[model samples]
Target: MEDVVLIYHNELGLAFRWKNTVPNADYERIQVVFRNMSFYLLQEEISKFSQNIRSAQFYNCSDCKANKSCRNILLKTPLEKMDISLNMQELSKLSDLVEGTLFKLDLQDYIWGAGRN
Candidate 1:
């Protein structure tokens, strides 16, 4: 039905919490400069919903390209919050990805893509 993928700054070296509420679900893991379970993945177990990724979060993202390429494919994506404290520009990149949600927390100066930071 639904699932979560949490990637910390460690570059996915750890598989912390991954499970399937569905009866017959799949999963997999892979390695690459940058990867997405749908296409760039070298291998994965959730082949069924590989294209149906739901919510994903980054704890301390050191580097991420997924935020630019396919960050908003799933119109019904459960993803709402992503901790982009380092790469503020990435959140700006999502300006068109999500208009109203670009910056709503800090708006004092709102210089950095709506946020004052």
Candidate 2:
């Protein structure tokens, strides 16, 4: 399954839509390949697939360094739209994250007056 995905990306550059018709195990393997790929390669793949990634969504992904790191990485990309649905504490850091990127951001699921910001 992983080989199939890698070959597809190498040949088609994400131009074709991928159907999630496989089992969770296959998905997990494919995810590992994605994780190991460089940010430049990933960006190229995304651009080749969609021309541009205009939007992104994050949900319940706090409390994990890897997840937060992924979010931070996305902020550095040429993204025009984003939605971050983490806790209030994390929201305070959004300004730093979304800096330099002109994006339409949506903050959600954060508690009011949660001693953040």
Candidate 3:
């Protein structure tokens, strides 16, 4: 928590993403470690950021090659709509809430998941 607070206050320019370490480059589904703490803190940070962010897109694309855009400042845009379907999978069941917000499937399985304004 302290680390997140420090980063949020001192280094607001950085957005932290937590993922498990991939091992054995030759293996397909290698066991990876999860950073649960950072994930939790990121959830909180997203909630806070959502309170004010009107136009933004977030995504994860592991299959991407090495030369992908790393930050929002480097992205091409018309200053209105943002496309983030690169690392996202097509979901089958996501007709419950607002559109344009599903990453893989509607995570509605989690109690009162992220819907609503």
Best by TM-score: 3
The lDDT of model 1 is 0.28
Pairs that collide in candidate 3 are none
TM-score of each: 0.18, 0.17, 0.20
| Tens digits of lDDT, candidate 2, 55-77 | 33333456565645444423323
Cα error, candidate 3, residue 48 (Å): 0.9
- Per-residue lDDT tens digits for candidate 3, residues 15-58, read 22223342332221111112111122223333332332322334
* Two-way lDDT contest, 1 vs 2, winner: 2
By TM-score, rank the candidates, best first.
Answer: 3, 1, 2
Clashing pairs in 2: none
**Candidate 3 or 2, higher TM-score:** 3
lDDT tens digits by residue: candidate 1, 1-117 = 136343212232222123555344343332111122222132232222222222222233445556643334322222233222213333333222222211221231254564444
Which regions of candidate 1 are displaced past 4 Å?
Answer: 8-18, 30-37, 40-117
Worst 10 residues of 3 by lDDT: 89-98
lDDT comparison, 1 vs 3, better candidate:
1
Task: Rate residue 68 of model 3 by lDDT.
Answer: 49
Clashes of 3: 0
Where does candidate 2 have its weakest 10-residue lDDT segment?
Answer: 100-109
Q: 1 or 3: which has the higher TM-score?
A: 3
Error of 2 at 114 (Å): 42
